[model samples]
Target chain A: MKRLSILMLLTLFIMVGAVGAQDAVTVTWWMEPSGSDDHVQELIIDVFNASHDNIQIDYQPQESINDQLRPALQAGVGPDIVWLAGNAAASQYVAGGFLLPLTGYADAYGWADKLLPWAYGAGIVAGELYSIPVTYESMVLFYNKTVFEENGWEVPRTADELWSLAQQTADMGLVPFPYGNATWQPSNEHLMGIYLNNYAGPDNVYAALIGEKAWTDSEFAEATDLLREHIADLGWFGGSLEDYYSLGGNDPTAMFASGEGTMMMSGTWMFRGLGPAFEETGMEWDWAPLPPFSEDADMQVGPYSYDLALGGNLGVNAATEHPEEVGIVLDFLLSDKARILELASTTGFGEWVIPLRYEIDDFPPGTDERVLRFHSDFAETTGAGRYGYTAWTFWPARANQQLWEAIELVWAGEMSVEEYLENHAAEWAQDAADGLVLSILPRE
Target chain B: MAFKIDSRVGVTSAYRWRQILSNYIFLAPVVALNLIVIVIPSLTSVYISMTKWSGLNQPEFVGLANFERLINDPIYWKSLSHNVIWTIFFLTIPVAMGLTGAFLLSGIKRFQMVYRVAFFIPYVIASVVNTELWRTLLHPRHGIGAWLAKQGIEGFDIRVFGSKHTALYGVAFVDSWHFWGFLVIVYLAAMYQVQPDLYEVAILEGASRFQRFRHVTVPGIRPTLVFTLLMIMIWSVPAFDYIYLLTDGGPAHASEVLGTYLYNMSFFRFEVGYAAAIGVTMALITAFIVAIFVILRRRGWEI
Candidate 1:
């Protein structure tokens, strides 16, 4: 009887609190901006505020979102929504229980069905929805059509042909790839995926990550040898391993933009930035898979390694006083297709102008035809893998550190691929001993 | 006689008490500020040093683990060596250039203020912006250094920064440009204060300018030179922003000073405890260098 009275009084208090609160509640949001194009977020916020009667949105642009949000989230005063890169770091948020579980909300609003299956699936961590997909990007090899045609070279379709071209180009005293395999991921990701897809194929690549085989597998050994030999012989990259940091993906894109180089391995997103340059140079540039292996074996450019399911998402603070109102805001902002398309079209106020989803017609004023056709072929062929696919994400931080350090040795010429792989395996096992997850894939 | 002695003792005791009271009164604000600002934060950091916290909520205690990792970590050692080299290198070039410029300018009677202003201008500029200016000047493509190569100068495309052989030195060169100015101004002031009599006596003896500089000017400014050297040694260990902005401790951690390394350990990898160990190591290094300077001073180095 006493409990029932307390429950009734509690319900009454909530009712009073909700009814008494008439002032417009302000919701703070944190996002990263790229000065000009990133301004689209401000417009979206303005539109949302103008249409809403009960809530106001305040946006904060940060230079380093991880550094800022990591502290804020832990302090329990984080923004209602945050923008984060799609990677293992994003998984850390979900794993730490800092993010609100949006599954219930998604189910209630039918968001799961509305979003692309792959896109919606990307943000799910431990079977819980933590973020919604915002943008998608894929890494592909871009080749200079004009340079190749001038050289009378057929576009390379396999690793051997690619190497042959690199050698031929080196003979003529020009940089072939101009890539240093020395930087951290996405660089490592792009390089390793290209090698693995050609050598072990996608099946083995996934298998290796999940412990179906060893990093010292013969195919892996051969691939590493092949890559190292090419590096030693042709010497494509002009800068040393350390110079890798100075060379942005865009640096090569800039090179491709000018008619200086024949090929660069980069993402389709960079195309938007480089399209004008390509047009000015009158060079037809297009994408291609890392050439498949010559061995008539089971492999193609292993499915695209990282596809964006979600760049970041908005989540309400679980401890906030206005959960219902926050929910209404989220529903309006994310669930409405028209709002999403507008947000997409404007490129989220310049955060990403290339919408995650776009039809060919939606290309910006000077989009390249060859570039689109190559991406279409590549996308259709490659399977999109999860982002944040670093060794440290699954294991203890030490294991990841050890792996990165070991790879540096390879570039330094102190260790071979076999030795490096063996060391990484040993380190991973050690991390397992120290209590860290080593596998996230399904068991056979 | 006894009364006189008693009165003297009483007066001394009273004087001591008054001195103590004034000292306390003078120190009260500083004590309060230290407790409120420095001491409390330092204690908090020490406590955080034992945890697995990434500057985030409820840090988990992992005592001695971070230290153990630092002891074994190769990059940690590599960074330490870089810091030591940086500290040693930072001291030499800046102090040498400063001493040389100070000596040359002190002899000039006219336009002393103009030369002083020109030398000190670089010191007043922000380090990041200054380092960036140097970056453009050193850029491999269109940099002034590269443009000189177009004149058929061999080794002109020197790409000094991104090279493993030259990256740290490149950063050091940039930092020296910022640091040497202060040393120059300090030395110049010390030189200006020297009595004209010393130079006059040397001149009367028919000593040349070089001899006068060595005999009179060097001895007169000995204390200033020692102080500037000690100051440079102290600043070199913790001075990270220049190296960070210029090279980002990269080109394979070639320019990894203690400050930038500790920052990367904490911010990049979220290894707070390990970063603390790095911080402690830095403090210990600074303390050790300061002690050496103190010993040198006691040995008649005269700073």
Candidate 2:
């Protein structure tokens, strides 16, 4: 009898082990290398794995995720989850039927209430949610505090003040806006967004995006003219088109840090490299929202709102065999506030796009105060509905590309501002008519 | 006796079949590899050129539309023109430099091997490293240009790769610098094979150095010269890495080459079909050049 009982127990144990083995599912994820910290993703994966037993997350870091993902997905063999740059990129995957609709996952995970309204809306295409944003960015005017104080240059708040300062700086044999577009042409879009939103105002820009207003409208043409005049007058980095094309990301930042330039109009992504760069020069830096393009009272959006962008938006593959497990992995990655705070602390600034419910105090101890303040200010201002469109995050892909190329032509004097605007309007209208535009929220 | 002869004939036939089979067995691997890597992909690319594919979804059939777009696209024409310019520059500059270097080196008796190795160093170095070296040297701010500017030299202060007027030439110059040395080694090998008697006869006939080089060396290396010219022409069609790394065909399509343009269209713009069409166009150009060479050869031209 005793021997029979022991045998029964052994059999039961074997059955349970087999069942547990069958329950285990490994989810594959391909992510681009995080610019801030390399090991933070590994650490996140480790924590998530430790917290769960039924699911194993396989983390792979790819240098060029889109380039690799395209062929793999085409072969009907891709990772369970892919980290995309933004909704603009995710929409392409969705259109190709490569990405699974996150609508069901969003509901199950309570993502709608968790994410910012605009961010949540941005990920939707034709009323279907497709991506969950993991990082956010915005272009702003970064000035050297030391340089400004030494030169008695007040930070510009209006278009007149900004241009006045630019002219004065040019007179002093210094660059006003140390812009560089050589390495990455798409960077031109950032400057365009700033000028368009501030000059033409967000409403006009939004209207133009949805095909309700023409880009050839006087406001857009004026914005282009303003940008062209600035380019001609200032001539970028070293005061020539050659310098503008030759200067890369680091060159202009280095110039600003060393007081060779007064200000740099760039995205918050620059923080990752700028911290180390500024360390050498002991240059203190601060960011301000871009100045209004005009002081006209009719331009309602200027002086209040600024361009906002999201990065590192991610989605699950429709072809993934383990959708449930992939969802669980994504939930863990997006919702683990403690791990997210830890990553933010290590990186010295938060590039992560967390739910608005998380406050600065929720961050890990030893997180830099300045970085926290920057995030907090942006969040508060954006939450208050004082935010505009960023081309990379919001514009349709073709339109966004056209914007960059057209701006280059205008700057090079190959195309007139009117012609550039007309071309943009035509392309945008076609895209909008084809139902290619992503969901966008109107400014309140 | 007749039956015995029939058996012997059967054995001889079997032996012949076995010999043929052994030859095929030896060739099997290489033939299979070529079919898999080259022939299969090339055929697929030709098919893909007729379809609209973003490389993510089902490729939709859109016969001739991509080609039509390519014809209408100004950027395509512009990039093709740049490739033509690139071919001309490589044909003239690198070929001249290589021939001159080979001729000068062939005449040298002391430290000949040292000179050969020294010239070949740049060719052996990775293109990325070579491009970076040139970028730094040509940089407007902290490079030789800046140093020269401090000495009151003005022209060097301007950016080479940045200017639309100069970007194509600047990139071609860098590529040529890295490539000309390879031509030097090839030409030198060909030059060494030429009999010394021909040169001696030319010298005896009171031929000047230039005359001897033009008359004897030129004729002797004609085959090599033609081969290198063909290679340069074909290679120039697919010239990508240097231009891609240096300027990325940017600052308003100033340095756009067909290779970089096709790459951008395929990857960045997601116009894979259009890019494949461009590829087909390039292949046609290569084939035409090859056909011309074949016809010339058939017509009894020495090359």
Candidate 3:
């Protein structure tokens, strides 16, 4: 009877607290600014506040946000809205029970149909929604159109043609891919995902992601060897491995702009810099999906698949005092498609591009044609059940770190790909056991 | 009469005790602050060091497993060894440069302030700016290396940081460039207080400039010298920023030190428990360094 009375008393207190909180409740969100003004967030937040009476939205722009949020989340206190690097990052928070499942909110808001399926699915961990991918991107083959035309070179569509072009370009004393890791060490993974998806095929890659296929499989081995040989042994990636490391930050990007390389395989984000880079050198540039790089039909890219990435993810904090208010704020943020498009258009369409469902014509007037074409291709391909995973977005944190860093050790000849894969499998196994591995959406 | 005398003595003792209590009460805020920030965190870290944590996940108690893994980890040993090398480099090169600059500046009367400012500019500038300046200036292709090569400087064509053999030393050189200036200012102030009569006596005895520097100048600044040694020892083991900014301990962990390694483990790899072990080990190493310095001072080595 005493226990029952204590429970009753606790319930009464909670009810009273809820009633008190309903008046003048403030829902807080911390976000990294998209641009100087962060017009998208500012405009939407202003609109929300103007529409609401007591529930005010508190949005704070932050830098070094992951570092800030980690301690806050562990202490069971933070902004009502939790920002993370991606869905892969949310796995840890999900494991800790720090993130509130957004499924109820998603159902209430009907966000499942509102976002791109791949992006919406990226937010699901352990068969439940825990995050929402705010920004989405993909990797593609950026080529010097001028260089291709001048040399009468065809854009390679298969493994043979790609290697032949690489050889021919190297023979002429030029960088083929012009890829290097000096500026961003994780650039290693950009090429890794490209080769993995293109050479091993997205299906095999997805199988490994879902723990059905092993990292040491023959196709993966072939991909690793091909990359290792091209980068270090054959000296085709800019120069030798050392040369690649020594490529003074943006030298490869500069080289691409100067028409020194046949192509540079990189992210859509590269478009922002490419215009100025090409302008300086009077070079015209274009892009296509990175081609299939395997002879086996099983390993070839079926139709097409773009390697996907999210700049970051947002989840509601489970420990927050105001879950309902936070959900309302999230619904507004995701639903405001015009604000997102405006931000994308103003920011030149990379960092501020949210993964809401879109039509090509919905883009405001003066949207770049290249941007539209990419969207059209991505929408059509992904709609037909074709998409690949970027390591940063899909791999667990440790595996992601190892994926990039250990590859350098292999290239430097300190470790073989077999040894690296063995370690990778070990890390993946631990992540799997710990429930830190993210659920990859099933292929159609 | 004897009872009254005993009562007076008791009162005096009680008053003394009260005075001591009041003194402690005055110290309470600072003590409380230390307990909150330092003592509590240190104790928590000890607990964390024993567990397997991924920062976000509930730390699973694995008792000394992390330490065992660290002991068996070659990367840990390699990183630790780099820290030691970094410490040795700072102790020697910066100390020598600082001593020489101080001694020279002390002797010169004209443009002393100008010389001090010139030497101190690198130190005074923000670390990012200083690092960026060196990163661009020493870049193999874009910087002086390429320019020198064009001017028929053949051997300088090599990449300083890209090579595993030279990466650690290259970072150390940049750090020393930014750091030696502060050392100069400290050593120069000490040189000023050194008895000028000793230098006069050395000069009268027909001592060479080098001899004066060795005999009078060196011994005169022994306290400052020892203090700087202590400072550099503590700072060098955690030497992160310049190296982190320059190479990120990279190419292939060629320039990896304990600090960068710990950071990578903690944040990048999300091996918080393993990282905590590394952190505790570093704290122990730092304590040992401080202990050595304290012991020497108590033994009157610096005094």
Across all candidates, the chain A TM-score values are 0.76, 0.92, 0.89
Q: Residue-wise lDDT of candidate 3 within A1-444, one digit each (tens)?
A: 999999999999999877866776899888866553456556667778878876888888778787788898777668999778776678888888889999999999999988888889888887889999877899988889999999999987767887898889988888888867766677888888888888899989999999999999988888888899988888877756766776756688788988777788888877667877888999888888777788787665574578878888999898999898888888887887887788777666766678889888778888878888898898888777678889989999888888898888888788988998888889888888877788788888
Clashing pairs in 2: none
Q: How does residue A196 of candidate 2 score in lDDT?
A: 89
Worst 10 residues of 1 chain A by lDDT: A347-356
Number of the top candidate by DockQ? 2
Give the Å shift of residue A327 in candidate 3: 1.7
Alpha carbon lDDT of residue A443, candidate 3? 86
Q: Order the candidates by DockQ, highest first — what do you get?
A: 2, 3, 1
Residue B140 of model 1: what lDDT?
A: 64
lDDT of 3 by residue, B14-126 (tens): 99999999999999999999999999988888899999998877789999999999999888898999999999999999999999999999989999999999999999898
Q: Per-prediction DockQ scores? A: 0.26, 0.58, 0.54
* Ranking 1 against 3 by DockQ, winner: 3
DockQ for model 2 equals 0.58
lDDT of 2 at B107: 97
How well does candidate 3 score on lDDT at residue B100?
Answer: 93
- Reference-based lDDT, each prediction: 0.64, 0.82, 0.84
